[model samples]
Target chain A: MSTQWIAVIGTCAFAFILKFVGHSLPEKWLAHPRIGRINALIPIVLLTALVTINSVTVKTKIVIDHRMAGLGVAIIALYFKLPFPVIVLGAAVGSAIAYHFSH
Target chain B: MSVKRDSFSLSFAVGAYGTAFGAASATAHFSILQTCLLSLLTFSGASQFAVIGVVGAGGSALSAIATASLLGTRNALYGIRMAPILKVKGFKRIVAAQLTIDESTAIATAQDNEKDQITGFWHTGFGVFIFWNIFTLLGALGAQAIGNPSAWGLDAAVPAAFIALVWPRLVDKKTRLIAVGAIALSLVLVPFTPAGLPIITTSLLAIVVGWRA
Candidate 1:
């Protein structure tokens, strides 16, 4: 089989395992106080990883760039309690403008 | 309740990124069908990009798949959280599993109440699926029409979207400290690791910090 197909199969298997765990687990376990507390922390950690990883890039040498300017704008929007869509648009516009001006 | 609206919102939210992916697939000489199928089926942004990036950079297919698989490991954790809420049986569970992605899982888990969680998952997942596919097709069809994704600064959008998702929840000093420390660690390690490993490593570090603090 082609490697892409093999990858797809592996991904599908992984997805199945995830679904089995998510969909079939007992309610008692899911609602367990400890689980809830741990779940609460999941978002904070996941989002931190997501944001930080997406924001930075390495060129020939590592240098901080304007890519994170959008993240900054989004942070400001969130601080002001803007809606999610609005925050995204504002950040997109900010990043686009920053990219345009930086070059 | 509002499956159509949710689908629309998800598509609109994630469609641009999907389009970028489609464009990249095209640049890599992948067919439109392959691009669309990948977006529709794979659905995880980072993993898909990592796979494609590896291919575009002349890496072997095995390397690309390994990268995708490594990046996708987090979906297992998402599943662990979502298991109880889905409540499907047999065949339905399979379909639901296919639909679960980062945004839908996050929205569902973040909801304060049960009703909201169900709504959030259905709306977000349905929306992202429909829109992601549509934009993937659009991007593939108009690959040349779209400028370089990098030049358009689309790469910045992912972090911007994530910050929008995350920054609102930071209500305390400890969380902020963990976030700062995690970012610093991620930055330090990004150069030394593969594409997405830094995020995973930094997440583990943040979890440790959060556990201790």
Candidate 2:
């Protein structure tokens, strides 16, 4: 009913459209090495961009905060190869604790 | 673990993380209804997060749509990779498309044969879909009940969760370099560029790296 909801539906349809295009494309088209290579890199690149935006910038400003501390703890946890839940919730707990202490 | 077991567990764990999305969406001023609808319809975690992130920051609805649509493109790529393996027609194709996501594609690709690949894709995709929606509902209700999400530091959970998600995927020096380079580039561009533009720009780095590879 609202603009946001309309946009949401449009976004949902785009995924199907792109996918249908993919399905419709011949294997030869899909098999282009460049496409495959770029696809692989897409996730890697997007994830990095997300991590940066989430960690460093809030809206339009760059500010450092307890999230970085949690990230620090997470890097350590990741290095030791902790499980996913542990790492995720651990980072949250770590951030919450640091935020509490800092404020 | 067996592939089925792996699929189920992976779906359950990652799907439960929808709770974060529910919480984050709440923090971003989405209603319980809108939030659940987001999970149900958009169904992509990163893109959904981008929507809330953009809208929450006083961005235009167009910007939110642009950012989310860009991220959802990856799902299309996943769809291409899994389509032949899935080999469904008509209504089944719709199911295949819905299930065509990063985890399902990954799990399906891990299998050596067509049968196993199809099995992997269906199990993981539907598993995640079902669990993700359920948890999203629970999470939205919970976030509403909790009152202010920020005081509980649910705001930090997003970035922390993102860090947790990305850290494991940086498997080698090349990916690590791209990660580091993208981060630095985005940081530099953040102040000068619009909110959503920097993300699209980062794909340039991916293009260069991928071209060289």
Candidate 3:
């Protein structure tokens, strides 16, 4: 009804359509070797991008900050082959300490 | 200890960010109803954030939709990745489509076997959906109280979870090289591009690697 509502509905619909279309693609198309190979790599690159963006940036500006400390701890935890929850906790605690001291 | 634990851990890591989103949407002047609708229907965290970020900055509704939709592109890509693996039809297809998201797809594909893959997909999808919605409500209601999510280092949780997800996949040198290149590509494009584009652009590196390989 309102502009905000309209935007919300429109965006939601568009997102759903995008998702549905991908799912609805022909099995033959998806079965192509190139498509399959490319799909396998999608998560790796995207997740890498996600990690970089979340750690280094505050909004649009790139700044080295406490999040990087969290990332460092996460890497070490991963290297040690810690459990998922522990690694997550280590990163959060690492960042929180750095954040408190910096601010 | 496999898909179940992985799904649960990944779900919580991803869902916890909903607090940040809830606080942000409320700060952007979205009514609780509007905020909840975005989480319920839109369901995608980054895209939802894009909507609030644009609108909160006094941008037009059209701009907000455009930006949010751009981020939602990744879900479509994930849907493509999951379709054959899921093999759902008719009504089930829609359900699967709705549940198709980053955490679900990531955990699903990360598993070794078909059973674990399916289990991971459904568990992570539903787990994240439940936790994300609940956290969104709490964040919206207590927007003022939450202050900065990053202060709790919740910001670190996302990337940490991402690292954990992708870490296992980088077993071979080729995949590892591609990951490194993507990280470099994304960082380079961050300042020059809009929020979501840099991430999307990294897919090019994957395509190139996949093509060459």
Candidate 4:
């Protein structure tokens, strides 16, 4: 199999194992406040990083482009507390317009 | 009855959003089959997105797996929350583990009574599974038919979706600060680090802040 396939399958297996381990292990293992605190921040940090990496960077270089405009529109939508789909659609529209003008 | 109704409505809404996932995965250059497999096998939104995002950005398989698994850590915590409430064993336990995700756990725990809790858990679990898979297929087919996903600015949708996912979670002052800090750290590291390393490195910030707090 190709490496992509391996990564895909490996990720799925890892996801399942993490969940299963939680079910099987003693609750006390993860019951610590410290663990909870760290866990709470993890997704926040990782996802914020994801938003940054996906939006502003292409490969190893950081370049200003339409994607930044898209992110800006998304932030506005969030500020207004719009629905999820609407926020995404607005960002896409904003970016598409910028992209059309740029090229 | 109320639990089932609530679960069904919530499930449909959540599942329909899988269309974005399907389209995003396709934009990330996943095959339709691969996209479906991600929905079927992985079945978690953020982690599945992280996989496609990393791999599509030219990260290695190891990096993809690490990022996806790290994002999935909360599901394990969800499983812990659901264990006593689920109280199953053997094959059933495995099945329960599979369904123990954010939506199901939240719905289950939200109910006032144990019966409603169990009912909410199973109904929402199965309902989301069915609808999410179906919508994922639909979205993949739609994205494929549209020719170039990027032309439609679907590339922008990926980060937009991440913003939407994380936005709600940034409920307080400290969380918002950490999120801003993470964004800054990632921006600084992007030029220097490999494709996926910047995101992974930001976890240290979380660890430090979380430990201190």
Top candidate on TM-score is 4
**CAPRI class assigned to model 2:** medium
**How many clashes in each structure?**
4, 0, 0, 0
Q: What does candidate 3's lDDT look like per residue over A7-30, in tens digits?
A: 688788988887898897765665
Task: Give per-model TM-scores.
Answer: 0.66, 0.88, 0.66, 0.97
Output the worst ten-in-a-row residue range by lDDT, candidate 2 chain B: B54-63
Q: Ten consecutive residues with minimal summed lDDT in candidate 3 chain A? A: A26-35
Report the Cα lDDT for residue B213, model 4.
Answer: 88
Off by over 4 Å in 2: A1-7, B1-3, B57-59
Q: After best superposition, candidate 2 residue B112: deviation in angstroms?
A: 3.0
Per model, how much of the real contact set is kept? 0.41, 0.49, 0.67, 0.73
Which DockQ-derived CAPRI band holds candidate 1? acceptable
lDDT of 4 at B130: 90
Residues A1-103, model 2: lDDT tens digits: 6656755666667656765666555566666788777767766676677767776677778878877766776677778988755665676677778787888
Candidate 4 clashing pairs? none
Q: Tens digit of lDDT per residue, candidate 4, span B1-213?
A: 889999999999999989989988888888899899988888899998888888777677788889899889899988887888888999999988888788999999999999999999999988898999999999888888887665688888989998999999999999999999999998898888888888888999989998988
Docking class of 4: medium
| Model 2 clash tally, residue pairs | 0
Is 1 or 4 the stronger prediction by TM-score? 4
Q: Rate the local accuracy (lDDT) of all candidates.
A: 0.63, 0.75, 0.78, 0.88
Model 1 vs. true fold: TM: 0.66
At residue B103, give the lDDT of candidate 3: 86
Q: Compose the digit string of candidate 3's lDDT tens values, residues B1-213.
A: 677998998888778767657765776678888888998889987677666655553445776687567667768778887898999999989989988998899889888898889999999999999999998898788765656756877667667766876798788888898899988997887677666566667777778877777
Backbone clash pairs for candidate 2 read: none
